[model samples]
Target: MEATKRLDATEQALMLITELSMKHGALMFYQAGGCCEGTQPQCFEKSSFYLRTGDVCIGTIYEFEFWLDKDLFDYWKHMHFTLDVTEGIGAGGFSLETPLGKTFIIKYRLFSELELQNLEAVRINEI
Candidate 1:
């Protein structure tokens, strides 16, 4: 099926971050071993994710990351393979359907807001 607005914990986290910046949380996405065999199973992460945009492949993009506290993290932890579950299998093969008549596709695996912040800190520290 074609997705109209795909979302994972990262994307959700991103939404949460954009909605409530500085929130702490963790989100997880499911990654099947590809649509074939012997592929590596892994997870994509987005810490303090926030925002939405568009991509060429998926049409629209609902940028998400992680940003939540302990309670929030706990909430997210149990939302794997079920709640907050979207499409894609690691990498850039995911999509989702939304009620707003738009579709989102994740074309890459990047860090969320928190991860970005962490990276920024690392960069500043190195500077």
Candidate 2:
């Protein structure tokens, strides 16, 4: 059986990624650790932000890696994360898209038993 992808993005997110890339060159996504808005995925210009040694790269969008803190990954590994966007200034506004009045949010659903068996591989410190 073909493996099920662990990540996805909405149409709005895809279009917004294009717009952000035009100005930022290359981009990446990270689900920052903390409460409130910090939990939202933050988009950054590739090479601008550093990926720590144990960070987990759950998947990618348009060649950009979607990363998370390892501790965070343990709690979310059983779910699929769909990247979405909404209007508003995200907390502290660190994401590249935040300045454009957008916040990258995740829509999640638990993996089905069958899907869990065929889910794509996840990596740590590897792209």
Candidate 3:
């Protein structure tokens, strides 16, 4: 059976990503577990942010990597994540989309039993 993807993106989010990528060259996403960002997804130029040990590349959107903190991955690994966009700046104002008056967010749903069984394996420290 083909493996199921752990992540996806909304149309609006994709459009925003395209815009950001064109402006920033390449992009990457990191879901901050709980810090000054308060558990929000942050977008940065691929080389701008540092990936910590054991961070998981859960999936990609528009050829851009989407990462989760190792602890966050362990907690949400059974769920499917949908990348989304919303108006207004996020709490941290550190993501690429912040200056554009939008913020990337995550909408998630639990994976089905079959999906869990066939879910794609995540990459560790691959960023």
Candidate 4:
């Protein structure tokens, strides 16, 4: 399905990438299977452009490569995505929300620090 609303969030993401590109030259949002509820975004230099066995190509804008895992691309084939911007959030990311109220948020972060910290603390405490 088409995006729910104008991809304003994506536009903001692209804008950020544009600024980052000046220094990094290349960047991409890598979609990998995380052992959790939502997907993880890994940003790196653009030279790392190798397609995996089941990768689906998304459109490229602002000199950035975009791709999605095959499973994820097919999973939301009928839903719409939109972007919501708020102050201090620095232009959030796309979100898929269905009429029934199920929502999925896609965002780009430098790393998974929160998850790592939580896991480390929990594992240390358990020992």
Per-prediction backbone clash count = 29, 0, 0, 2
- Model 2's lDDT to the true fold? 0.87
lDDT tens digits by residue: candidate 3, 33-63: 6656656788999978888889989999978
Alpha carbon lDDT of each predicted model: 0.28, 0.87, 0.87, 0.42
**Rank by lDDT (best first):** 2, 3, 4, 1
After superposing candidate 3 on the true structure, give the runs of residues whose Cα lies further than 4 Å from its correct spot: none
TM-scores for every predicted model: 0.17, 0.93, 0.93, 0.48
| Candidate 1: segments with Cα more than 4 A from true spot | 1-97, 109-127
Give a tens-digit lDDT track for model 2, residues 41-87: 98988867787778888889999999988778888989999999888
lDDT of 1 by residue, 63-104 (tens): 332222222232232222212324333333322222222222
User: Candidate 4 on 3-112: residue-level lDDT in tens?
Assistant: 22211246655555566577667666444464542453434567465656666544344545555666675553232333222233221233211221332235433224
Model 4 segments beyond 4 Å from truth?
1-11, 36-38, 80-127
Model 2, position 59, has a per-residue lDDT of: 89
Candidate 2 similarity to native, TM-score: 0.93
CA lDDT, candidate 4, residue 16:
54
